[model samples]
Target: MAYVIDGDKCDAKITWLPVSGSLKTGELVELIQLVEEDDKLSREALALKDIFNDIIEEGLTYPQLGYHDESRFKSYYLSHAAFALRLANSGKVIGGFYIKPNFPGRCSHICNAGFIVDMAWRGKGAGRFMAEQYKLLAPELGYRASMFNLVFVSNQGSIHLWESLGFKKIGVVPQAGNLKGIGYQDALQFYFSFVKE
Candidate 1:
């Protein structure tokens, strides 16, 4: 399945929902549970849950998860420009993406984004669908380019998906990712500059 963005196409019954507010804490907790407990998901997610949970739960504030990494919860990444993917037939959040400034001030025009597909939906095209939607949505959000800063080298499916969507491999940092099955491997950086239509 794919998201209809200009020329991009997908046959799945799905819709892209614009992110309105932060994920509710209850929903976030459930999401964290899913990420942590789901054995079918990519091992990278399971391993990072140790660090990822802290980042998210700390921002769960109004309640503090204490000593959590707040670095990943940047206001830009949680902005309304983000998107939630759901079934067109039924509003189930199968996946989503967040958009944020890749750098401050001078380089803010170039954005950064991340996508996560729910465990139940991983093999069902949710990831690619979100990517296509993001490309179309990025320009509307005032970004001229988008970058994925740390795509793990072992995630071949994602690497291929991004490349298919017009993102280019800009560079790689050797042994930056310690994925579960793949162990320590190169981490790749991808960049895509949108052409105004």
Candidate 2:
């Protein structure tokens, strides 16, 4: 089961300034937060669902074994602060992420986030762009730190991205993921702090 944050504990208002930049592929993209009432929610969600399902089918990044239906997608990705990366010209949703408290009550200050980039856009710097935005936005949402609970060790791109962004590998859970074809693989836990001690 996925981790769920208590509604009362994490009341941080989620909002951010949209940012635009060019990808390595030379496409300009804009990062915008997705609110429930936004007119683009349905359309964006449809595209994102396909991208998310493709990743899940690959069994490399996310842990979900089966495809995510609309309800499941909303509950998992849209429960809290969500953002999407869209082409500046076409407004096509190519990637997105969600942020929520890793735990409830006293631990609510520490946030956890999940990200997905459309397969076609992979390796073109979309992931890095989203990670950079996440670093800025997480703190703005009142999170003091961020943690990724189950990053598969085989995911070199993600491992590199997190490390380059100053997220420290705090621990590793052996045989944490029963990935497709590869069987069980270790998962790495990463943490980054917004507040310096």
TM-score of each: 0.61, 0.93
Scanning candidate 2 in windows of ten residues, the lowest lDDT window is 7-16
> What tens digits encode model 1's per-residue C-alpha lDDT throughout 116-144?
66555566666665566677767766779
* Number of clashing residue pairs, candidate 1: 1
State each model's CA lDDT, in order: 0.53, 0.87
- Global Cα lDDT for candidate 1: 0.53
Give the clashing residue pairs of candidate 2, or none: none
For candidate 2, write residues 24-108 as lDDT tens digits: 9899999987766643347877788889999999998788889888878877887788888999999999999988889887889
Name model 1 segments beyond 4 Å from true. Answer: 1-80
> Candidate 2: misplaced stretches above 4 Å?
8-16, 38-41
